[model samples]
Target: MGEDLTYLSFRVIDKKGRAHILEITLDTNYPKCPPSISADVPHIFNLDWSGNSKLKDAVVQFEHHVDKLQDFWSTLDDIDRSLWVVDPKDPHFAMSYRQINIGNDCYITLSVNASDPRSLPQCRFLGSDANVNLLRRKWKINCKRWVKDRSFSENLTSILDIELPQPPEVRKDDRQTECGVCYAQYLPIDDELGSKSGSATDYTCENNNCSRAFHSVCLRDWLRSITTTRRSFDVLFGNCPYCSNPVAVKIINKK
Candidate 1:
C-alpha cells in the first residue's frame, strides 16, 4: 500500500508463469465502496463488490479472471513465436489483433477472441486481389477443420495450405539494427565527415503493418527524391519505401 493507506498493489503469477501487477485505487470510503481495479490484461474487469467484500476478495476475483484467459494467451504466444508478425511491431499482452506476413507481399490479420480463443477467429487477408481471392477460397475450405487440440501455427499451416514464412535471423555480428534503406547497421564515418551518433538508424515507420527503419540522413534524402513528398519546417512527409504508408522524418540540422 506504499505510505498511502488508500492505494494497494498485489503481484500475481498466472498458471502459465506470466507475472502481473494488480493495482487498486481506493476511495475515501474504501470499505464502504469498491476500489477500482487495474491490470495488464486486454480489457477492464468490473469489481464484484458487496458490503462484506474486502480487499482480499478483489484479488481472488482478478486471479480467476486471468486464469480464464489462459487458453487465449497461450494461442497468442504460439502465434508470436512461430509467425513473422509485422503488425504491432512491439506486442503487448493487451493487444488482441495480429498481422502476420505470409510472403509475396501477402499478409493475414486476425482478431483473437479472449473468451474462446481456440475457436476460429475473425480473419482477413491483405494483398493483391488475386492473392486475396485465392486465400479466401482456401480459408472457406479449411476453416471447418480447425481443432482446439492443434496449436495456432499448426492449424494455420494446414488451413492456409502454404508454409508460413518465418522472420529471418539477422547476422549476429551487426545485430538487427540495420536500416531498411541503406541495409547497414551504421553509416560509414570518415575523419573528414566527422559524423555524429545520428549515423545509427534513428527513424522508423509508424505504419502498424510496416515498421522499416532508416537513418535520418538516408530517409531525408529518399523523401526528397520523391516528386510527391511534402515538407513543413524541418520535417519531411512521404510514403514508406517498402509499404508506401505515410511516414514523416525530422530533418535535424547538424553543425
Candidate 2:
C-alpha cells in the first residue's frame, strides 16, 4: 500500500477555462508512526489558478468522503491548510491545511478570493482517493446545474409581465403672455412696440411665483455666465426674480 498510494494528482478548470493542478503525497503509516509519518504527512503540493486574470476572479469547491474513518475525520482531527500568494506582485499562489473534519457525511468547502495582486488565496484537501472522487463528482453536478439556470431572458420576461403605471399628460396655453421663469405677466411694456408686441421681455423662467424679468439679451448673458461657472440649468438654482418658488426658464423668439 505504501508504494501504491505514494502520490495523487488532480486538475481544476475555472469558468474562464483556466487550469490548476494539485498534487499530494501519502504516507502509508500516516498519524501512527513518528519519523516515517511526519506530523505534516498530508502536504499541499500545488494549488494555483490559470488565466491572465488574477485568482480573485476564481472560485474553488471541495468535498471529502472518508467513510471508514468517519469518526476520526468527523472529530476535527484532520489538519486544514491554505495556499495563498503573500507578495502583492506575485500572480499565483497556493496554501495547505494540516487536518480538518466536519460532522456531515461529507465535507464540502467553497472558497472565493477577491482579486488583489497584494493577496491571492487558494484551496486544498488532505484525504483518500475515494473522498476526493466523491467531492469532484458533486462539484461537477453543481456546475452543470448552475449553467442551465443562468439567463437574463427569464428575468426580463418576468418584469415585462407586471403592470406599469400611466404617466401624466402635458397641456399648453397661449392666452396669457407670461415670463418663462416666473410665469408672471410680462411687465407691461411701453406701447411703442404696439398691441401685438406684448412685453419686450421675450422669455422668463415660468415659475409662477418668481419676479426676475430679463430682456432676451439679459437672460442669454445670465445663462452664458451660469454655464461658464459650471452651474446646472436646472430649477435647483432658484426661482426667477418674479416668483418666490422654483421656476423653469424658457426661451421665446420675438420674431
Candidate 3:
C-alpha cells in the first residue's frame, strides 16, 4: 500500500532490468469489484478480475505486462539520452513521442512502436517549410539503412547525416523553462482527444542576466493578480518574477 491504504503501488522490472511502477486504485468493495490501474507504460493492460481476484493479482498482471515492453523501454531510453529532446520538456516513462531538435530552426518528432521497437517509427517534422521539406527528403533517402541491430541513435544519425546534440553533460542551469506561474508546457483538458494544448513560452525577460521566459497567458493572469502591475491601453506592465526588471505583454484578444 502507498500513502493511503487504498492506493497500492508495486515495482516491476522489465527483461532489460529497468524498473517500472504500477499503482492500483482499489475499489471500496475489494474482491467483489475490480481495481483501476495506472502504470509507467505506453498502454494500459487489461485487468483480469473476478470475485476471486486479490490485491496481489493486479501487481502480478502488471509485472507480466512489463516483460513484454522490455525492448520498447530500452529503445526510448537510448533516444532520450542520446538527443537534445525539446518537447515534452520533462520526459516521463509513459510517453512514446519525442520531439528532438535537429538544427536550422527545425525539430523532428518520432513516434516509436511499443511492440516492435527497432522498426522505423512514424515521423513528423516541425519548423520552417524549407527545413521540413529538406529533412523529409533526407529521411526518405536514408530510411532503408535502418537496422534492427543498431541503436536508435545510430539509425537516426545515418538518416539525418548530421551530428546530433546530446543532453548537456554540464550546464549552468538544469531547470526547464516552464511557465513560472502555471509551471507546465502542456495541460490536459480531459482524458480524451478534446484536451487543450499550451505553448511553452512566448515572452522572455529582456534582462540578459535573467532571461526567464513565461507563457503570455500565465504572465497576464499573474500580473493582473498583483497590485503593482501597470495597465496601459492594451498592455500590462510588470516586473520579471526572477529579476524584478520591467516587462510588458500585449493583451490577447479572444475575439
Can you write out model 2's per-residue Cα lDDT over 1-255, one digit (the tens) per residue?
236766545554322212334444444553232112111112221223333422222222211211122222211111111111111221222322111232122332323222221111122333566766655554444333322132212221232232212112213342234544334555445454344244545544442212234554344444433322223543224223222223334433444
lDDT per residue as tens, model 3, 133-212:
88899999999989999987788889989887665543325434776667775543433322224445666665443356
lDDT minimum window of 10 residues, candidate 2? 74-83
Better of 1 and 2 by lDDT: 1
> What TM-score does candidate 1 get on C-alpha atoms?
0.63
Off by over 4 Å in 3: 1-5, 13-19, 172-255
* Model 1: per-residue Cα lDDT over 104-217, one tens digit each: 899999999988888888899999999999999999999987888888788888898898887664343433367877898688874432454437787675543345677877
Error of 2 at 82 (Å): 52
- Cα-based lDDT at residue 5, candidate 2: 65
Candidate with the larger lDDT of 2 and 3 = 3
Q: List the candidates' TM-scores in order.
A: 0.63, 0.19, 0.61
**Model 1: ten consecutive residues of lowest lDDT:** 168-177
Candidate 2's TM-score reads 0.19
